[model samples]
Target: MKKGILILAGIFAMTFVSCKEDAAKKVKEENVEMAEGRDAKNTDFPVMSFAKTEHDFGTINEGDVVEHKFEFTNTGKAPLVIVSAKGSCGCTVPQWPKDPIAPGAKGEMLVKFNSSGKPNQQTKQVTITANTETGKEIIKIKASVTPKAKPVSGTPVSK
Candidate 1:
């Protein structure tokens, strides 16, 4: 009986030690993962770089739709994510890529400016918000438009 009791106690001690070691290992792994996540959140890198900071669309006629494309490159180590893009007014509309751009990849943003209600020399700006090393990237586009003169009607004369 005495021998059996000693063996059971020994087995229980061994099991407890093994469980404690496993718990410690799990905690260590969790700490490492948390550290990595925090680092990623704080990391910043440029996803794209524009050849020209701004685009200028020459003079355009009223009621005409003017379109332009702004090109850029992923100049960072990580993929580039564009959060959102917005135009200064309703006359200008912008379209951007929905997917993340990998490093060294190329991307573009297409912009269309409607001159239906716009007149005279005009300058517009398109703001792009991105997840990059710089936090946010802003790009501007400008244009000038001339509305066509109304046609003059002549009085009908009897021939």
Candidate 2:
């Protein structure tokens, strides 16, 4: 009777452990699915194809503000949704679409850079979070900021 009771208890413990592992695995799978979204398994997830990922503004004077429009297209079967866009620094601002772009539709990202205190060969990055498979993308802008030019007095310099 003692042997039978010990065997029964061991079997119950084994079953409970197996069930707990299975439950954990199920929860992990569900979490993955939730993080990836329902279309995660789809091969044709939204593709963010930028016409140009980087822009060169050449040389700009200090305190100058410049703008650029980055064109892009959704080349995937799924709709492209730009979740958020942020600049690398406060002086750089990015504007992106707030709506979902249909497949093959065109869109643009407007980025503005304020070179007030920025100097030299400055590279600004705009990180975009989107519904694409990779989930994030980056666009860059380069500019060389020159010092503010000193104004010349109208009066001629006396030698």
Query: What lDDT does each candidate get?
Result: 0.83, 0.93
Candidate 1's C-alpha runs over 4 A off are 1-44, 151-159
TM-score of every model versus the real structure:
0.66, 0.70
In candidate 2, stretches whose alpha carbon ends up further than 4 angstroms from where it belongs are 1-41, 149-159
Task: List clashing residue pairs in candidate 2.
Answer: none
Give the per-residue Cα lDDT of candidate 1 at 40. 88
Model 2, position 103: C-alpha lDDT score: 99
Clashing pairs in 1: 45-133
Single out the weakest 10-residue window by summed lDDT for candidate 2.
19-28
Across 86-123, the per-residue lDDT of candidate 1 in tens digits comes to 98999889899999999999999998899887878888
